[model samples]
Target: MTANLSTPPAIPAGTLPAGTLAAAPQPRLPAPGGLLLRPWAAADATVFLAAYRDPEIGHWHTRQPASADQVREWFDRYGADWAREKGAHWAVTGGGGEVLGRIALRGIDLDDGVAVCAYWVLQAARGAGVASRALTAVSAWALGGAGFHRLELDHSTRNRASCRVAAKAGFLLEGVKRSAAVHSDGRHDMHLHARVRDDGPPA
Candidate 1:
């Protein structure tokens, strides 16, 4: 028999205050191997555009900015999201400040102390643990100083590299959402993963 999918009953009030995230400046987190996770800048439009242009990124991300102007607009939106406490996005950069990847917490729900994580590494930076390092840094900040209780990550089941990154970053596989995500080719199942604050430190 199919399991019931009704909304669960509401619990107690929010774990954190309303302005918990917005009250503080977005931090520039340090990752392993001299990598840095910082807010996106207006000058990053060029590399931002290039990231979406990559075939693999395009295949999974599915949305692209048509021009530098569009990328700037996206940067603006990201700033607004940060101000509104709805999301947080960061650019993973090398020691020389070269853009290496992107990481973010989307769909932030302060009431529930939860958010979803997303990330992508540039083609040149792949296989160097860039994504995992960025993810681990963000997760630590989110669950520790940021006051978030849980962080969730989901990716297309076919994206084996992403699955590996999640695992390496301490996000345990929760389950699959059958045919839950749409890709360039068609719909595909998604693997859901999560790391809660109580999970303790990463191995």
Candidate 2:
């Protein structure tokens, strides 16, 4: 059977008509507590740098604290990528104008109906359901507009917080790959999870 390469099937959080998945776009989404999820702008780099400064964030993320020049370059390349649709990133912000984290749908494959969802939230934002909300909003858009059927997420085995976020986002534990990569001291295991289009509900 041929997949719909143009528009992905919508998996609405709420009930809808039988053919709604094939119908118009779902209502625009607002992040939890009316947080805004939108594309990152150049001015948002300070927030990015601040969020990355936490040692905990650096431990999991390969990239260290970004330099001012590096942040500019990063934003430049980020904007270009989104403009070309190669991939996209969004900054998660609270109603009070605090930057919570960033979520991205990279490695998009329209033919295969798949993409990679990756994110990291500030320490203060942890356990606040921010990551889950950001993920849900992005997943709905990808499934409803971008033709993605499966979304994969990965993290170092030591990142329990990330693992919890994946579960909260409705991704099931798939498997683990030993020595997935070389860490500062040695190899590290990687946890893999996925949420298929048919999955029940997203937290």
Best by lDDT: 1
For 69-99, candidate 1 gives per-residue lDDT tens digits of 9999999999999999999999999999999
- Model 2 lDDT per residue over 91-170, tens place: 88888867788888787554466778989888888888899888888877776555567889888898788888888878
What does the lDDT read for residue 98 in candidate 1?
96
CA deviation > 4 Å runs, candidate 2: 1-29, 182-185
- lDDT of every model, 2 decimals: 0.92, 0.74
Alpha-carbon RMSD to native, per candidate: 6.8, 6.7
Q: Give per-model TM-scores.
A: 0.92, 0.80
